[model samples]
Target chain A: MTRHRAAATLMPLMSLALAGLLVVAVLDLPPQSGLAEPVAGAMDRAGVDHPVTAVLLNFRAYDTFLELAVLLLAVLAVWSLGRRDPIPARPVQGPVLHGTLRHLIPVAVVTGGYLVWVGSSDSGGAFQGGAVLGAAGVMLMLSRPRELPMLPAPLQRLGLALGVCVFLAVGTAGLLAGHGFMGYPPDWAYPLILGIELVAALSIALTLVLLFLGGRHGH
Target chain B: MATDPVNLQIYLACGALLFVMGVHALVVRRHLLLKILAINIMGSGIFMVLLGVAAGGEGGVDPVPHALVITGIVVALSATAVALVLMLRVKAATGLARLPRSGPED
Candidate 1:
């Protein structure tokens, strides 16, 4: 009881001290009006075209490609590292939670698909959707831990390669048409952007799910 | 209210807070999963900071930062997967969820 009291007393004091620091930090900020003009000028130079798509495919296509490569490497690392390890048999935890997740998994999967589909125009996208799908896999694992399927090595490799493959294909096609890498012909911009984003979202989602599943050899 | 640079400042501050918290988590937590969460939080902070920096003018938020953030988000998840896999392997080997401690040698 004494220990509980001591912790309770200390928590509030710590919180109050933190709150005071936050207030001071906020108060010290410079006034807002002085920063407007320079920022606006920078924005003007950036060109107000389809900024999001342009940023992804043109301005920083190199970064996007590398990012895809990183996911591929991660999948490979996990696969190689886990190859020699013995697989632990997962024990069944509870029936109630398992039953609940059985229904929840499909819902999560459908919602994730919807998010990826609508990502181009809406607040959600492939990343969010993929995370949701990964979470559903997590839920399934937690409930029916032993039932999770092992991912085949070839399929896992394919999943990791998918993102990079799509990216390079589009980029090379663009180059063949007399544009630089990833520089789509003006008429083909929207279609190509949608295609790339869709593939990226799916590949990324699967890679993440595989990662969460601990790169096991089955599922 | 009309667009203001102050909003950008607020976003920057939020990002800073997220980063500091992530650093603190990295220092204090031994659990690998929690560490992954901390890393994600830090990535989120970076994204927020970039977006805030780009939101300079009256026009819509800069697409460059948005694109960068999206890429960052993907990379973060990729890193998270690799980390999680490592953690799982460690768990399988040691039967513990926490990272191995460095011994006092030197």
Candidate 2:
């Protein structure tokens, strides 16, 4: 008991010390001009009108590509663990949930699409759109008392792999054209970024739903 | 940037404090779920710091950091999903939601 109490106290003390150091660090940080100016200067060359979108899809495509891979890797890891256990009990569905979902899913789908389309010039983007679509998928899953049907195995694999595959293909095409890897030709940047975002959003939505489902549906 | 310096300072302080609290919870809590949540809190703190700094710069908010934080958020979500599944597997295998305590003191 004494040891436990001692550990508890020691842990808080350590945390406090760490907190103080972090505050000091924050206070000590040097202020300077930021990359905003540089990004703005490059905006004409960048495909997207929104600075954040340009940075994400053009200036730093590599990061976004790797992020997609990470999402895919996560689902792969989950699938490897085991088949998911079924929900313990099914609560009888109320008409309210059914009615809500009936109205909600179509709205979510349209909103998600609009977000992806507007992302090049506004706050909405692939990730935000993907999240909305994913939430709709989760709602659909919850609404169904029975096991939700899985996509055919091949199609499922293709959907899961779509984002990375399309991204790599585009990058490879860029490489072949001598714009360097992940680079789009000056005129082609807008369309390519938009296309990639669309596919990526679709893949992200699928990945999130699969993650929520918690394991692979056994073949 | 047009952002207020005082507000920036407050945000940075809050971020640092949040990170500290997350560390504290991670250490003191034994539930695997709480540990996962604490780690997420830590990530949120880092995001807050990034945004605060992004706003502190002159001219405009830095788009690079905004992009980085978005990437970070997606990565964090992916990580959390995997961690939750792993926790469920652990619970099934060990019959405990908390990890087995192991220490010289124990």
Candidate 3:
């Protein structure tokens, strides 16, 4: 009891001291507004108008590739930790839930696609699109309990691996062509990025739902 | 695309406060879930700082940091999933949400 109490006091003091240092450092940051123009040439090389998408898909594609790999690693770790959990007992669904499910899935799919497309020109991207799709899956899981058992195991695995496999394949091809890993040729950049993003969104959505499902192969 | 520097500073300050709060929570909380939550909050604070710093140019916010933050958010989500599963495993083994006593010190 005494140890806990002592920690409570000390932790706040340490936090405050750290915060003071952070404030001093943050205060020294000279604010620069507008798009940092330095990266414009790199953006042009990326072949898309949206600077953020260009950065993610071209300027620094390797980071994103590794990020996908890391996500897969996390899921693998989770799976290794235990046997498949039995699906939870079905909740009694109200009429309202049924109605919402009827409408929500279609909206989520359309919006997810829209986000994927918008990512190239404006805001929204694979992650956001995938989130919407994952929500739809979760809602479907909730509304249709029987489908849980019916979810095929192999399909889920494919969804989980699709993003990384596709990305790596493209990157390796770039290397084979002497363009280096994750390099987008001046002409191939647009199609390659959009195609990769579409697959990535699918994989991301599946991985999220798989995370929710938990255990090996989400069985 | 020019933005008020004062507003930007406010966001950075908020991020700093969040970081400290997350640190405090991580230290003070014994529950595994709360610790994971504090870590997530800490990640959010860092993302906010990145955004604040990157938003300083006239051509809209720099896309590199924006992409980085998006990637960070996804990575964080997976990490939380792993943490939650670990917590579940720990609970199953020990029947406790908080850590078990390491020895007879108590």
Candidate 4:
């Protein structure tokens, strides 16, 4: 009873302390007057409509490209980790869960595609979509681990390389168009963004799924 | 009080809450999956803050931060994938779900 009383008292005190700290922190923040106005104004002056996509594929194309490379490296790391290991048998779990997951997989795949498509103008995007699709693979592993497909080494490499290849190819195309590396030829900007995003979505989803599988074959 | 900065305050507060929750999760959760989720939450918190700052106490939101967050989401997933693989291997090797501990052993 005494310990319970103490715990009850401590909880409120902790909560109060946290609230006070939050209030102080909020108060300390700069007044929201003149933060990103200049940058927004500049974007307006430059006539860079669809600034979000423009910034993604044009202004910061190199960063996005490197990000794809980073994902590829991650896939490679997972592959190396599981190398030379014999595939293990799947764990035995219940049937209801398995059936439910099977149903969910197709829904997830469709949702992922939708996200990639709508990402052009909306909050959703390739990464979000890719992650959702990757979750489907996780579901497969969890529900029917025995049925997991073996990702051949070559295909694994291809999955990892797909995004980077698309990004680099587009960058190269831009260079040939006299726009220099990673520059978007003004007319092709939307199409290139769409293409890069689509490929990146697939590559990212595959890499994530493979990671969950530990790059191993199911025995 | 009607300067109408409520939206800004709310966003900033949400960001702070997310950051704090993420920190708590990182410290307390032993599961690798939970840890990765915590990290993503932290990234999202930072993203919110960036967007809030970019909002600039005005109507138009900044596109730069939106773009940055998009890139960040991808990077976060990449890291998550690698971490999940490592966790699976660890689970396979140790038959334990949590991280390995360093201690004086027999």
Candidate 5:
């Protein structure tokens, strides 16, 4: 693609002006010092000590659920486009890649699990865990580097739907119980969130890996 | 919003800088991949602005914005992945890496 010389020259100038305006706008902001009492209470009610996790899975679970849906939909759109050329265009066996993946995969899985576990109480969460797992999948793909489906069709489909379905089901169950959508019973909040995170992590991990793989492999 | 207004200003400025750079890239770059990268940069900038603004609110670093940023990162990646796939498809079907300046409005 030939570069557009005029646009290229103008861009930096325009960007600088925009940056200046943003800097000016930011300078007017006021600082906050402490957590408000009501917010602190909401954190407590979230069943998770970490305020961020509380917000993600409790106060605004709908957002997280929708995020998962978006991920799944992205993969579906890719699949709908039809098959991808086998990765590498040329198949070459790499003993080096195998050696690295052989060790790296276990670490990825363990770290992913650890992140998911710690998310409720600390900085880690489903997205981070899913990323680690997805990274492992990419490592696997590098070693295998095939156009063929590494996973069975049914499993791929299942993974794609798993997170969203679990989320929706729980939300619906809450509604049935008259607790409002995605509102867990107070007594069950902790376990419910933990379980949902685990399942959502699995779905996210698989969906991401599939999307990266590009096109439908698992017929 | 930020707990410290100084940090808030710094972060929002950073975000703004990134967004401007991304917009520049999107306009100036001819490659599809570069455009996608530019979009991701813009997304990150927006996320930074979001967190920066929330951190400066009446209450300290609010959970809501933090969660939203986290969600945004994941969503951004999903969108980038899809965009990359689309780019690849376009390339495969046509020999060009990007649409011609005046293609049929893809």
Candidate 6:
């Protein structure tokens, strides 16, 4: 009991001390220009027009690829846990919501596609688009009629693996062509990055929806 | 435009406080859900700090940190999903949504 009390008391003090140290560290950091200049200098050579896209897809493609793998791994872990219990039927169907969804889902799909397309030159990208698509899928899952039609098992699996597989294939191709692994040739950067983003966006959308489902799809 | 130094410091301080608060919550709270939430708060704090640092640079905002934070967000989402499922399994197996009181709270 006394030990518990001591630990409880000490935790706040420790946290506070840590916070103070962090503030001091932040204050001590010298003001300096970040990697903006270097990134800018390399922009033309980068496949994409947007600085963020350039960094994400070109300069640091490995990190993004691993991120896709992490998403896939997460779904695998969830599926291994057990089957997802079916959603209980809602007694009261709100017609308004169903009506709205009827008009909204197609728009959401178009918006997601636009986001992915605009990503090369703007603030939107694969993740943003995929998230939007995932939201639409979730809406469908939640509000659709009880006998919701799920994608066939194989197709679902394909969608889930699409991102990482495509990314790996592209990276390996780049390596075989004398560009480093995950690197783009000077001329092929744009098309290659866009292709990766499109497939990655599809995979990301599927992964998010599966994560929402929370377990294995079928029996 | 470069962030004003004073504002940048303030943002950094806020981020630091958020991270500390998250750590405090994660340690003090016993509920599995709260712990997961606390972890997310900590992630948000780190994102804030990274963006603050990105903004304080000389010529332009750093794209590297922006890219990093985007990756972090997606990773966090996946992690949270896995954690939530694990929590559900724990609940199903043990019939408790919170951790057993084997620590300070006990």
**How close is each model in CA RMSD to the real structure?**
6.9, 2.3, 2.8, 6.1, 3.8, 1.9
How would the candidate models be sorted by TM-score, starting from the highest? Answer: 2, 6, 3, 5, 4, 1
TM-scores of the models, in the order given: 0.69, 0.95, 0.92, 0.72, 0.89, 0.94
What does candidate 1's lDDT look like per residue over A1-219, in tens digits? 565557556655664565456545643554333333433444333222344545555556677778778887887787777644434445556786667776788899899888766655556655677678778866665455466455666776776687789889988997899978866776676567667767777787777766765555442
Q: Name the runs in model 2 displaced over 4 angstroms.
A: A88-90, A145-148, A216-219, B102-106
| Local accuracy of candidate 5 as per-residue lDDT tens digits, A1-219 | 234556556567888888888778766655553443455777667888888888788778888999999998888887887655765443366876667767888999999999999998999998899999988886676566455556777877998899999999998898899989988887788999999999999998898788877874533
As for candidate 4, its clashing pairs are none
Instruction: Score chain A of each prediction against the true chain A by TM-score and list the results.
Output: 0.67, 0.93, 0.89, 0.74, 0.87, 0.92
1 against 4, candidate with superior lDDT: 4
lDDT tens digits by residue: candidate 3, A1-219: 777667656767888899999977886887565345766866767778888888888878999999999888887888878645575656787787778777889999999999999998888888889899988887776567344574576877888999999999999999898889999787999999999999999998888877887774323
Candidate 4: regions farther than 4 A off = A1-27, A31-50, A83-103, A144-148, B1-4, B24-41, B84-106
lDDT of 5 at A73: 84
When 2 and 4 are scored with lDDT, the better candidate is 2
* lDDT of all predictions: 0.67, 0.88, 0.82, 0.72, 0.80, 0.90
Instruction: State residue B29's C-alpha deviation in candidate 2, in Å.
Output: 0.9
After TM-score superposition, what is the CA distance of residue B4 in candidate 2 from its true location, in Å?
A: 0.7
Candidate achieving higher DockQ, 4 or 6:
6
Show the lowest summed lDDT stretch of 10 residues, model 6 chain A: A83-92
Error of 3 at A181 (Å): 0.9
Interface RMSD of each: 6.9, 2.3, 3.4, 5.8, 4.3, 1.4
- For candidate 6, the docking band is medium
Q: Which candidate achieves the best lDDT against the true structure?
A: 6
- For candidate 6, write residues B1-106 as lDDT tens digits: 8888899999999998999999999988999999999999999999999999999888889999999999999999999999999999999889988997777542
Error of 6 at A125 (Å): 0.7
